[model samples]
Target: MTFHTHHHEQVAEELYDIFESSFDEIFVTDAHGTVIMVNSACEQYYGLSKSDFVGKHVRELEEQGIFYPSASLQVIESKQALEIVQKTDKSRYLHVRARPIFYKNGKLKSVISYSRDLTDLMELSHQVDKMEQQIEFYKRELVQTQSDITGIIVHSDKMKKVFQFIERVSVVDTTILILGETGVGKSRIARLMHDRSSRKTKPYYEVNCAALPETLIEAELFGYEGGAFTGGLKQGKKGLIEKANCGTLFLDEVGELSLSAQSKLLHVLQEKKVRPIGGTKEIKLDIRIVAATNQPLEEMVKKGTFRRDLYYRLNVIPLYIPPLRERREEIIPLVHHFLTVFNERYNRNVEFSPKVFEAFLKGEWPGNIREIENMVERLVVTSERIVTIRDVPFLQQETYTSAHLSLHQKLEELECRLIQEAYEEFGSSYKVAEELGISQSSAIRKIQKYTRGIE
Candidate 1:
């Protein structure tokens, strides 16, 4: 071989070695944007061999979605250097920069596109975003917890876990379903989540679905345009959803919504837009939804009363508040909280007697926090400085003798009364057992069984 020809062939070999050994993906396309060569890294990135890409037109590969917005094609068209981000069909992100090579005559020779895999970086960015959201949520929660008026009382471990979960999810703009009995403070939980969320400054409206009449529920939720109905306002009326834009909408007693209303609500949730009962144009919304229900929604779904799709949408995050009888540790703290609240509200310094506290500890608060608040207010308003056990209306009515009971019934009543008194006197199951001469497990079992029936 001639000396100059051998020297040029050696240079080409070195260049080819460098191109094939690169960790990044490298594609060399002709002036017409046809793939002439691709590095082996393409196989790792797109799960396709180099042969699959080579000899294919850039436009054809882009149409096939191998990697969208082919950088080589853009460089070919513009005849200049281009940098762009592309997503492959395998869902991998690629950061690409393509530069067109030119001949001495200023004619395009080839395009060399270099791509670095950014899928891991993109995933890490998403994780960082989630962590930042959690940090923001905790900052709000810290302020809320340190404030004097913390609205709700939490003493039981069960409640503590629930609050922790709320703190984590409050920042996420997902639907939350608060599940509990009538007065276990489901609405309070919902409000707490909204207060800790990003939309706290915006309007937070609570709509009691059960309180709204079935006939007007639709119109109330999705407002009516002018002349849409016989009794409609002359100007178009904004619904609760529209009013709660960029905020939160708490749907209390959500299970009471009719099936038709449920379907419309589902559509709004899915589409993020709502059309009024008589409106032709749809109103867009940016709102978070928190729903509460005492009813068993899953059972309602099985019965075909509740829409299954709607139930799934609302139940994305379910927070269940246990009954007062189950978490009796909260009872005394709640009573103290209510006492302080009512005393300040009524301008009365009424104190509960030891026996009154005992009665409260032993009683089953089927009506939950609402009942406690009412009872404290009643005592603060009506009682003397010291509210005695006899002052409690429920306890006063429970004064009964076992004279009309059978032997089994009498023993059962005596067992229940003794357990209640012991539990009231000694708070913990172990302490109650120490006082009542029973096993600790038995004390716990008896407390669970009898506390609900004590009053």
Candidate 2:
């Protein structure tokens, strides 16, 4: 019996040593809520000595305000475990867990509690939340910057759908072909695609195929060797394709490419390499192609004027922009956008009258966004504070006033004007019929009727 008592005392001493060395604050209280034991960590966390709490009732500690609403007392009363966040008088945060200890007779024996400091973790969580908010703010700013850089002003459902498509395709590296009528902002859309893409920081090259002569376009696109032809630069020049390496190349009026040029372009697209004229070496390229045309490439393909294979390669991702007449809802917003732009450019604050808006909304925008921008710039530079109907150009005034006519009369007048213009330009009923996509008999009858009225 004496040896067993000594061994038990040695075991108790070892447990006390372990309890003192624990990193977490640990305390034990009797069933009556009197403090019985506490670890050394409590002194550093709560600024209290073990002697200050040992043998003292929890209520006494609460009255002295050493800690508020004692967790051990609650666990004793409820006979269950409880978790809480407690703050000390020294401005330290603690995550505390208290559990009731039971005896062999199924009766409560004591309460044990554990607490860990939570100050650093809580501070880190707050910092992360602030960083997330800042990231969201910068994302919104980037979106606005992209819109401004791309010159995209959209409101109508038709154009909204187009914008959505642009966003969806910006991440891809596939070739994109933009189909739209002349002056319908196809070039702007191409730029928008480039701006939204991951290659935005790289160089962007634009070439108007129709603007360059057929004899010069091949050399312009494929570049040339030193002294390859008359008037050529000594060092040779880098073609737009080479200039757009690892970036985007916008080919405007791609349908205007001659057959030989189209064949060369197709080879480049297939092999991702460009060979300069009169040069033996071919330079490899990593470029995204964005092509635009006012003409129908599919019809050109059917007529054997455009290579079917090249058309397929360019048409991998086709986006069609509707004309201004189909999206009237966008006119006012576009006008306002241009108004703000020109107002700043010319340093004027001109405004349009209600009647002017009425006239603008009613007229057919044949030249699309380009014409609107030109008109707004004209008004900003020429008109006074408030632009009235009379401030519009004489030719446009006639166009605007004609919108007041009945729908039937408007259609008839437009048809007559078109027929007369086609006859004058082509000078033959067969040519007029072909130009207007109508039968020869219909063209002859319409031309005669409109001409007779003119006489």
Candidate 3:
């Protein structure tokens, strides 16, 4: 009996020593929820000495506001282990786990509580949340920038091909010529090319050849020295070409340039140098040229109205954008896009009726994408929440005519118009089929039907 008592005492001393050396705040409480023991770590973390808590009821410490809602008291009441978050008077956060010790008879004997400091972990969590919010904000800003910078919307195969070609040619430094009718987004394509090119970070200069008079076109393109021409700036302003150094210069409506202007532009292209009018020295240029024209340059070259050398120089890379009627698939998507834009601008939520959509799809959009966008904006501002067919006055006559015609006849008319326009643009059944989103045989049959009487 004496030897057994000595061994038990030795084991108890070892356990106490282990408890004293622990890093976490540890407290042992008796069955009545009175704190019987506390480790030295409790004093360092809770700002209290062991004597401050020893032999005190758990409820007493909580009432004194040393710490709130004692974990050891919770374990005594629930008679089970629990983990909880607690706050100390010193404004520190602690994660505490309390385990209830039970006798063999299932009666609670005592409770041992362990607490770890949680201030660093909570601060780290807040930092991560802030970073995630910042990332989301940047993402939204990037999307808005892309939308504002490049409003080009491509959904049809025809426009998709144009974008693919732009992507391929953007990396290379060469002159590009865009051919299309007015308002077919030719200038937009020019801007897109510049945005995608290596000189994207530099200035993008645009000159509308047709917008300026013949007399001013030369001075606008090639800077004139002070006193070179009447009413010119005394300081001799830099021209578009010089302003666009190390960047891109877009010449819109290039076919409108006079013979003298054309010759000067050609010289610039050949020598990569421009001489200011009445200036003795030539300014060397490091610029890329992108020209757009609605006129047929080839026919003009044959007519001797446009210079052949300049034509070849500008036509190095030819990109033609078909009219909206030819690529009908893009009409509805473009309509929705413009609708969204206008709705936001006017702070309205207007919606289109089913019949309105049908009229827009079937009507001849002569001005192409620009016309559709304008009409949508007009309707968004002028019409109510629901835009019906009656809102579009221009389509009323066409709709009445279609109402009288048989279904087959109406479809034939639409098909004939599509085939004729596609053939004119593509010049081949295979290409027409690809552009119109139809089979080659169908395109050929329609083309032959539509062109039978003409040729």
Candidate 4:
């Protein structure tokens, strides 16, 4: 053969090799959308042999499960390049793109497609959606937490004293016990301490001792290693103590911790170390423990339900929070605060009626500040226009009718009510000390002193 003919043949063969070995799935089709060419990945994706696909119509092969051909239709219809996604029953998701190929006279000739599978990307999208939902859920929780305390009006001197106590003790790491009637913002005060303290920037882990069963509580406070038991994460988990390292741990309803749990917790407080469940290694923590309860812990120790030694350890800094009733002066400000917050959340312009304020000042609020917050949220969620006395829930309307008495007698009565109520609410004098706003050990001594006075 002539050298010229041989040279031409060699160039053509190299071009063919490049087309065949390319990573892209390149197909040339006539105006009618026929498969003129394909590459290796295309062959694997559609389970097709070269000869079988060579002369086949692109759409027909897609129908016969040979290759995806929808991109060709898009290219034809739009007269432009566009991206499309495809899914197969047994395979993952895919992203397909199509572009029209034009002839020299500005007439349409055929379509070319470029594509990639997107199954993993779709999975990543799903994970992103779940994360967004979780963020929204936590945002709602934070709003509710803020609202719960906003309901307790705090104009009273006693509550101001509690606030002052919190301010004074915030910089110290002394274990603080919060004493108050149920719903009187003991947990909020605990948070205030953490927020104000040197540990404000660290994780603030909260535990509700009564919310979970004893078996789960240990694992929650100190994470367990995988195989610690059936269904435990394969790799052991970090305990809350570890999470609270260089942070603060808030123990709510601490009076409810079982004797076993209390002993373990006391060890943590004394030595600043925690040993996780099913794990031998002990983790050291730089944490501040804020224990709160509506209970009478000293009484519990007297009854032998709680340990006295643990109480003494936790009562290093005693801060008391008075009930909403004693702090009647705080009612208006708290109500306004909640009203403004809920108004924005519920999308309304709401204002309290004068009578509602009157009812608030007079009510006993056995459920304390929490009840007021819940009521405010309810009104915002369900009511329309400016809220009035009539719009307030049934229980709130009845608060003004419960009592009439002398000022000093009333103060004494409220104080006694708080003491008895706290004792019943928490069942231990130590808890009473904390929630009623005193040291656990002091709560013990106060109960002893008071009971003797009544006798």
Task: Please write out the lDDT profile of model 2 over residues 61-130, one tens digit for every residue.
Answer: 6435466446787787678897654555565556677899899998999999998765554445445544
lDDT (10s digit) by residue, model 1, range 11-128: 9999989988998899899999788898888888989888888899876675455665467866876787966656677756576778989999999999999988755643454455
Question: Which candidate, 2 or 4, would have the higher TM-score against the true structure?
Answer: 2
Write down the lDDT that model 3 would get.
0.78
Clashing pairs in 3: none
Q: Model 4, residue 367: displacement in angstroms?
A: 1.4
Scored against the true structure, residue 267 in model 3 reaches a CA lDDT of 94
Error of 2 at 446 (Å): 42
User: Candidate 4 residues 1-455, lDDT tens each?
Assistant: 69999999999999988877766566667767777777676666556667776777755554443332256765665677865444332354345667888999988898877666544543444455446547646644444455333433344678777777778889988888887788888776777688789987778878888999988788888788778988678888887778988989989988898898889988998888888878888887788888988899999989989999999988777677877777765554555556656777677886443335545656788887777777777877787654544565552322322467667766655566566445433435666777978887676665544432110
Across residues 100-185, which tens digit of lDDT does each residue of candidate 3 receive? 99999999999999987755544454455446547646644433332232135565799899889999998888999999988788
Best of the two (2, 4) by lDDT: 2
TM-score of 2: 0.55
Among all windows of 10 consecutive residues in model 1, the one with the lowest summed lDDT is 142-151
- For model 1, what is the alpha-carbon lDDT of residue 332? 62
Q: RMSD for all candidates, in order, please.
A: 28.5, 29.5, 27.0, 30.7
Q: Give the range of the ten consecutive residues with the poorest summed lDDT in model 4.
A: 446-455
